[model samples]
Target chain A: MTSQGVWTPEVVADLLLTAESSRTPVGSVTGRWPDFDLAAAYRTQDVGMKRRTARGERVVGVKLGLTSPAKQRQMQVDTPSVAWLTDAMELPPATVVPRSRLIHPRAEPEIVFVLGEELAGPGVTAARAMHAVSAVLGGIEIIDSRYSGFRFTLPDVIADNNSSSRYVTGSVQVNPDGFDLALEGCLLEVDGQVVDSATGAAVLGNPAHALAFAANQLAERGHALQPGWVVLTGGLTEAVPLAPGSHIAAHFSHLGSVVIKAD
Target chain B: MPTGLAGQHDSRTAVLNAEAAERLLAAYAGGEPAEPVIERHPAADVSDAYAIQRAQVVRWIAAGDQVAGYKVGLTSRAMQLQSNVDQPDYGHLMRSMFAPEHVPIPATMFIQPRVEPEVAFVLSRPLRGPGVTIADAVCAIDCLLPALEIIDSRIRDWRITIVDTIADNASSGAVVLGGRPVSPRAIDLRLAGCVLYRNGEIAATGVGGAVLGSPLNSLTWLANTLGPLGVTLEAGHVVLTGSMTRATPVAPGDRVSASFAGLGSVSVQFAPEQQEAAR
Candidate 1:
């Protein structure tokens, strides 16, 4: 340890900055933040970034990340991770993005819920998270990172907002009542080619459960996902990569389809 | 205010102000650069971070930008480990992020780009309530399909604090869905195999098990998680489970394909840079 026997913020920042600059994974950054434990380092970095966001004046949304079993298994954890959101990043349906500025871009069709009320911990359940949702709809998530070459560790990934980028939705916004997410199926098409099919069950059995898990997780952190907040359940299927001048469409067996194009 | 001709005003100062505002908005949208701002105010308190983010969101919405939806990240074990979190995080998506299918990618739009194979789901009924079960979730789905997600990021050197990512929408880039659908009950999703082919060669191969062992299980977890949060899974919505296999990167001129057992397959052709430039 340094003479103080405690990790210093400068050390943590410098290590993190090096990792980011080098486009190395979080595992590598760990080597630099010797005194700063991985999780503790994350918490410290989180606090610093949160302070920055607050100083700039932004609105906080629910924390995201931690919806994939593969991720959990890889991380050797049972629960998912999350990051706060501000109002500024919200986009409308069918928004177009330039391909050049993004570090690495990919897309996923997801079920999004907009909460009507705030829910907290103490018995946070999947069903309860569902009840808090005001509407559910089909959406496309465009995931991007600020890191060049898109290299980072799990810790780095979470710290980077789970690599969240942009999103678009379909016109049909419906009240999530009596929906059978698992049994439903979807067809993803690129141009006119028929490729890829799956069911809602692919997303951690049911997407509602993912949302519920996120809600309770947030509650444990003393941060409640308020009403009117938006929650994106895990992806129903694997993510699709993007290219310029491409047409991406998702047609659900019952939910209809949402389409977008790269310009 | 001093009554001065519009042209006579300090155009440079006004320009600087506008530029500063734009940066502020972007910082608000994403996270502020870890570097200290010129004014050098004391560091912000963590508790107040959300408030500031929310206010900026309101301003963006008021500016006529559409509220597309949201994105969940760090939900996967790999990501959680990489990010050093036990749970997932989330962010919002805007309309400006959408890209069409089969469109040639312009290399200039992204600092870097990569692709992943996935499955997308569409719901037929709403799945809500705190006690929603797997069976209940099963009954709510309409169809599922093979898909691809293009993940990109905006941070320089990919170095960003967590809050920086939170403001950036989880580094989401674009999405492409295949033209096929199937029922969840008809196949063994957990055992299903996914083969990712790049340029007619196997670059990566995995199974449904890779994605939490059956994408449905992921959804079930999501439902349970959201139940207490007052959220629900509605009909006519879509969900993207985590990757069924390891993420394999693709480049221009690379033709990619993913085949799933019983569910079907999807593919995309990366165009030549010159061809993309022509577009």
Candidate 2:
């Protein structure tokens, strides 16, 4: 009787969780773990999220990684990967994030949606998907790689939940009807200097399409986006580094601004 | 534990619209606020909120109420964070909503009322717009008057989301307009400044540019936003050009006033609890 499996989803999830909890970085899983594939990667993500939920962390929303073509090319992936966000990952407004708890963190500005209704799909269009959105807010995502040098393959990242660390949303939540979201602009600033800038179009042409894709992708897994859930579409511009006492801010064209400082 | 949930969005939307409108209407009639409607109407979006607002307008018109004007809300950055909404929204000002200048208003007329200083635009001619310009809006104006908007919430403790405030008529309660009316071109409206005082103490200071780069732009935005929907800024209609500073709280017997640099000054008082003002 064989009682051992080295590359099972549960085992991979356990190893990833252990490394994540200790704030330690590990190498890529490619060629190291046998039977490691994309489907198994997704299963590992699901199992990891389940363990988090079991520990009393509520799933607040979902986040998309590698949504942009440039990001996909850099990661050598054609499709984006999805990850779950828990309440424990939320950073309250005006609170400084302590960098000592993180191995290395980079910040990206995002277009976030707070859904007003359930969005389920497989054949959903961006126009139809927007009907479910209530408000849009500027968001900052802290993406930390649990893998060394932030180097990982597609399956490696999907299993690691795209290295999500924490997120903070702006105080302002505006109705999406107020502006053309595709042209929505954002400026990523560090220490009061503009470091990066990108429009909403950078995120998969339009963020709404990414949202539609998210809904369709969730449907594939027998899940759906529910009301009041916050969806982080994806990072719009290249991420910038975080250091102690750095004044970081993302100013959006119409969605107001979100500012954070690293302590 | 769940099954298919497709093709039912339309019917589900209507139910949410009706339920949202009903609660807000009840709160309006009883002069008492309700719990935040967003919690109960999970599917209410901005469009759904506007639909609820329009439904109430219909009912109010049927009840012999006359449309007075329009009031814009959440114009400044500070106001955005205060109310937790990013973009601006507007509400209708019924004929019954205007309070006389320098008169004491009854406290019971509103629930958790706060005051805002504004530059009121009383239109001279009807303005229709899909692409209305700033000049067109300035040309339509008869005059600008110093004004105070008594903003009240129909959501308990002002725990409002965007849907909640829009459904409650942009958190509007009463308008107090006064001061010597000045021609639109008599002064640089963008640079116009004002000092708001509450009970003989300076409360807030701001300039006209605080409202969407100028109250003129806000006027054009209103005309353009509503014109596509078939709403016009009619002649003699008073357009409250949004708040210039953060809204300050008001209580019974409290006196509040605002002095504008070139537009003169206006004031209002909240009468002590004795009897409700004539409605």
Candidate 3:
């Protein structure tokens, strides 16, 4: 076996412990392996961190970011990236957070799906991915870069878990067949003031499309959707920044609403 | 007691070892270039790539995957030449990536997540065939709403070729909708303005006309583009034509607002982290 094959759960656990204890941003580890593939770096990094979680850390839903066309152009890429989620980063709906913990953070309204079975790739199709879903809910994803300037290239961000920080989901589920998801209104409010607005259709025209795209993407990489996997699908609106004493609300037209507070 | 280490590399359980090699090769030598590489091939072959991609998509759909919808890319002229493509290309959006409300998302979700102002269209009628006009596209719309598109890139350092991105679905990402829903005939979409703000501060600005000189133009082009493929946009689908302006990054504890002139306004906020702050 190659030296890289020496990676083990213990190694991953220790790395997560080190990162958490030292609070060292993964960016600092960059030159340590200059030839490391960015995507592989992310998976390797997660392997270490995930090892800790497997020992008792709660697994939260995965975080989906880069749900914008302009961003894809800016990054010179055509596909979005994803990261693992853990319960340690979850916040209740309308929960207020402190402003000082993040270097840069933004919140976006997104449609979340819970898988009823494992969805994996190679031959995974959009219909198969949808069939694996058990429920759908409205949620807000908070993205933050541990990097100081919030100016990472695509590789930097990928290694940083796509800058996923915290997520808050509302308590509602709509069967995949129930609503016209592609065309639903989404209203976001801050401090009782309407700040941003759009519709579910804005995301590649509908949230379901994001699923199809993601499913194809994972399949291309030989990964399939597994049961119980919660995919963040793409964002349904523009991302808003987070600040203290701010209240955010997302009204998903027919689906329902999600509320959060920053204190 | 074990056998020789030779050829043992094939028995490794790590998925990364095998995948990384292929990804690296594809990145460097395969048809998929990691960055823009000028190939002196005929224009016909360049265009043929689109057909090839379409065939691949059809195979997947026939394999039991549904065509959830379509994503229109390079609607802007600037984006057209940036990737060295003379025209725009399309990709499929599936159902597996859809997200629902109340699900907490970790911050490390995307490669380079950013938000752009947009306008979304829900068609009341189907659009098909050539000779489709902007007026036809507009007439088919059910409602129009202000939208924020969260775009991300899958390539490292956000470096990619247009063909690579086209295969990746135009880098389409998350989308947020707000503002009031207005009928297609309500106002002059071209004259509309889209002003975006972060933390109550103006971050980026744009106008509807920026989207291929009126969002309807995007649909018109999209319809014509799809006609050759025997694809027609069905009713009840949302069409996000393109962005009205540049995208901006969002942060936690921050609020974002987008104002579309003559339509209405919308907003959202990100939660804060007291624990990290308490440290």
The local distance difference test score of each candidate is 0.59, 0.83, 0.62
| Model 2 TM-score relative to the real fold | 0.51
lDDT of 3 by residue, A1-263 (tens): 12344433344335434544454544423333445456554665466446648778666556556656657778787777766677767787667754456555678888788888776655555567677778888888887765545666665566666766778877888787655554345656666644555555456545666666666665654456566667787666567888776777876654577888775
Candidate 3 lDDT tens digits, B1-279: 346553363244123222332343354233343332112211223344454345545555766766655656676555765777766666565443333322322223444556667787878889996889877887899998776666655445556577556533566555556747898888666645466777765565545655665678888888898887788988876677787666677654556667776567655544444532543
Runs in model 1 lying further than 4 Å from the true structure: A1-28, A34-38, A41-45, A48-52, A55-57, A191-195, B1-279
Candidate 2 CAPRI assessment class: incorrect
Q: Clash pairs of candidate 2?
A: none
> Model 2, which residues run further than 4 Å from truth?
A1-263, B1-8, B81-86, B275-279
Q: What lDDT tens digits, residue by residue, belong to model 2 across residues A79-173?
A: 88889999988999766886888878889999999999999989889998889999999999999988888888889899998888899999988
Candidate 3: stretches off by over 4 Å: A1-34, A98-101, A216-223, B1-279
Docking class of 3: incorrect
**lDDT preference between candidates 1 and 2, better one:** 2
Best by lDDT: 2
lDDT of 2 by residue, B32-77 (tens): 7888877888878888888888887888899898888998887775
